[model samples]
Target: MARTTGSHSDITGPRVRAAALSLFAQHGFAAVSMRQIAREVGVQAGALYNYTPDKQSLLFDLMQTHMSDLLSSRDKLPETASPLEALETFTRFHIRFHSERPEEVFIAYMELRNLEPENFEAIEKLRRTYEDQLENILRAGVSEGVFKVADPKLATMAVIAMLTGVNTWFREGGRLSLEEVEQIYWDMVRKSVGA
Candidate 1:
């Protein structure tokens, strides 16, 4: 099908993806219909096909976009000197990045089961790339005797889980500010690796 004309064309694609992301985050992928997404986007059910081939494609696109953004943003941070500095940077960055994107983070983790095998593989590849960033830091720390991580791979997984878990309970106006939370978590991560 030909694309929609005029300014509407530019915005419709993003709008559709945003609507689908919100819906899929609230209701599982299996539970949300294309029509529901179209309704949310203020477009006809058939019109969604102009932007996405089908629901599965839309789901894959959302996940792919989220992971891509995560990688791109991470790559832009300034390089740190020591492995300890890099690990602290990674810890603070993960908490801040994942916290701001609660919805995307939720769908990224919860909706993985809904992706087809190939799509799942692709998303997992991107995820591993992100994880490897931290794992490498741990390995360097261990090599330099700055950290005592027996298995960098296992330490990577644990640190990521601990940082990501902040999203589940953190709020803007609660007891601690996000900066404070970042510091507290960084301290815990530092201790965990024996840095």
Candidate 2:
């Protein structure tokens, strides 16, 4: 990677990344080009190399950043909270977080096939960590007889899929507020677990 020459590389670097992420989300990663990303960022083509080694690195950065934010944004549920409470918390969090970042969510799912093998594995690991949190909650519910989930792992995947699907057609003013969407999804999740 080339060292950034300009003092404004600090600002320019993020702008470059933002441009890359936006373009990658709109046009598939394979269809986008380094020069296009540079053009979007209003930088010379060579200048993009100062911020990233290659376009793949830019894609990896966007994916890793999104996963990191998803992992860190989850607050630990209260120690004394019941299984149902923990489940509700996870339901609401998944919906709210993914709904707020439609572009990131879209790219995260849509561009996984474009990732290099190692980058793909890293992203998958981070996603699995998030899945494990919900699976554990489901397991706790099953142990407590509060949920009749036959398979915690499958239930976790299903519930997450159902919740994340809200981003596809949900607009803020399109008949349902975000809170209502969250509540509706939460209710479906609650019933899905047989709680």
Candidate 3:
């Protein structure tokens, strides 16, 4: 057994997840094998077992980690910030974060069918928690007469879908910088919310 130690083990997990996510996104989850993931991670097939019990567990871990990081980041927004400011913060964060981790975002959105029912439910719940934060901000804005949304929930989904779509087209060598992309998204989001 190749015993991974120290920071290497910690680094290996994310690297493996990233590789798995990219492969799974390119070739449907059902088409991927543990050996493939292990190879991509530059480890022996059996070595992957040291990081995750099985393929399903690996998928679950990826989604769970992404969602957890998302929620934690959103939760850190300043409490005194206005709903519009919060929305702006969310918009910028969503674009920048997703842009940097497109593979993870692609996996999270595309590999839902591969997870078992229990794992799927857990991931879905975490996703909703993040969505709810945006909805709550929209609702608060509407209540304060700062936003004019007909349905905060639907608007929340629309905004997120639009923002997340950025990862699909954004490239490191793209003409617009990440800051510019964020500003464009922030403008669209503000307009959509009537902020």
Off by over 4 Å in 1: 1-6, 75-80
Give the 10-residue window scoring lowest on summed lDDT in candidate 3: 70-79
* Residue lDDT tens for model 3, 65-128: 9899887775466778999888998899888888877778888888898889999999999999
Q: Give per-residue CA lDDT, model 1, range 1-195, as digits (tens).
A: 565575666889899999999999998899999999999999899998888899999999999999999998873445547888888888888999999999999999999998999999999999999999999989988989999988999999999999999999999999999999999999999999998
- lDDT, candidate 2, 24-129, per-residue tens: 8788899999999989988889978888999889899999999999999996877999999999888889888998899899999999998999999999999999
Model 2 has an lDDT value of: 0.90
Model 2 TM-score, 2 decimals: 0.95
Best-performing candidate as measured by lDDT: 1
Note the residue pairs that clash in candidate 1.
Answer: none
- Which residue window of length 10 is worst by lDDT in model 1? 73-82
Q: What are the Cα lDDT values of the candidates? A: 0.92, 0.90, 0.88
Evaluated against the true structure, the overall lDDT of model 3 is 0.88
TM-score of model number 3: 0.89
Q: Please state the error at residue 110 of candidate 1 in Å.
A: 1.0
